[model samples]
Target: MEKFTKISGIAAPMPMINIDTDMIIPKQFLKTIKRSGLGVNLFDEMRYDGDGNEIPDFVLNKPAYRDAEILIAGDNFGCGSSREHAPWAIKDFGIRCVIAPSFADIFYNNCFKNGILPIALPQEQVDILMNEAQKGANARIEVDLEAQTVTTSEGEVISFEVDAFKKHCLLEGLDDIGLTMEKVQAINAFEAGVGATRPWV
Candidate 1:
């Protein structure tokens, strides 16, 4: 996982609520376990038509938001199934941060694990971000993980809360595998001692 410290970039506004995993990557795109290629398929159903052509009206397909690195979505974002692929697609698409009024517990946890910052804020704060996102590439939003603050293009500051452990993990680029590696020396020592004391067993 890549470290997420601070990011200032374009934010795409998706006001629809209840954006589930299926809508994000679709069942058809789940065959591959790899996370790299999923960005093209992110929001596949919404981005393509029946014939597989890009929809002009989709926020991601629009020229201004094609490179959006942040998302400002409506309430109840990431509801339904606990698929890790959802965050993978979002991250692969270059979205480092997501701001919403609320998020599903499993999805919120998955974001941090995948190096994506999922921010939950009050409705008023989210509304402010959503409005800023509507400006597309012209307005950039800044998310400072260390400070736990989001500054809009107009310099409006909003504070958000994140768990200390999760913040540390993201800042240090430590995923489950990375965390385990931190204890390698201790694990090796324990194994050596066990072999010396209980070789017969």
Candidate 2:
């Protein structure tokens, strides 16, 4: 997992609610468990046409938003099935932060586990970010995870709330595996003691 202390980059706006996992990366793409290379297939259905051509109108396909690293989404974002792939695809696409009016509980937690910051804010705040994202290449957004604030293109500062524990994990790049590794020495010592004491068993 990568540390997400501060992120400043392009933000793509997707104002659709109830964006489920299937729409993010179809089930066909789920065959591989790897997280890399999922970016090309992120929002596969929306990005491609029937013939597999890029959809010109989609925000991600547009030249300006092609490299967007943040997403300003609508209400009820990340709804439906609890698929970890959704966060994988978003992260693989270089998006580290997502701001929305609301998000599904499972998906929100998944984001934190995958090194993606899922921010839930009031509708007004999200609306402000959405407007900033509309500027495309010219506009950039800044997310200060430590400060818990988002700076829009117009120099507007919007504050958000996040769990302190989750913030600590992201700042230190500590996922479940990373967290476990932190106690490796202690774990090893404990195992050694257990083996010696219970050798007969």
Candidate 3:
């Protein structure tokens, strides 16, 4: 996973609540295990019409938000099934952070694992960011994981909380496998000793 330290980019406003996993990438697209290429299908139903043409009114379909790296979503974001593909699709779309008043527990944790920051802020603060995001490409939001702050284009700063351990992992680009790799030398030594003592096996 890529390290997520600080980022400044377009912020897309998605105010709809209860955005489940299916709405994100859709159940039809869940056939693949690979994470890449899912970005094209992100928010499939909302972004496309019955003929699969891009909808003009959708936030992501709009030119300004096409490259948005952050999402200011409504409450209960990432609800429903615990498929890890949701975060994969978001990250693949170049969205490094998701800011909402609240998020489903499983999805929230999965974000960190996939190099995405799922921020939980008060509704008032999220609304403020949402307004800023409405300004199209003219407005850019900055996120600092170390400082735990999200700064709007107008210079308004809002702080959110994150677990310290997870923060360290993201900063260091350490996923579950990366974490274990940190102790590779010790693991190798222990394996060697076991082989020496149990050579008969």
Q: Kindly list the per-residue Cα lDDT of model 1 for residues 99-185, writing each as its tens digit.
A: 998999999999998999999999999989999999988899999999999999999999999999999999999999999999999
Writing each residue's lDDT as its tens digit, candidate 3 over 117-153 gives 9999999999999999999899999999999999998
Q: How far is each candidate from the true structure, as Cα RMSD in Å?
A: 0.8, 1.0, 0.9
Kindly list the per-residue Cα lDDT of model 2 for residues 41-139, writing each as its tens digit. Answer: 999999999999999999999999999999999888888888899999999998999999999999999999999999999998888889889999899
Over 4 Å off in model 3, which ranges? Answer: none
lDDT for 95 (candidate 2): 92
If the candidates were sorted by their TM-score against the true structure, best first, what order would they fall in? 1, 3, 2
Clashes of 2: 0
What lDDT score is found at residue 99 in candidate 3?
96
Q: lDDT of candidate 2? A: 0.92
Instruction: Report the candidate with higher lDDT, 1 versus 3.
Output: 3
User: Could you tell which candidate, 2 or 3, scores higher by TM-score?
Assistant: 3
Candidate number with the higher lDDT (1 or 2):
1
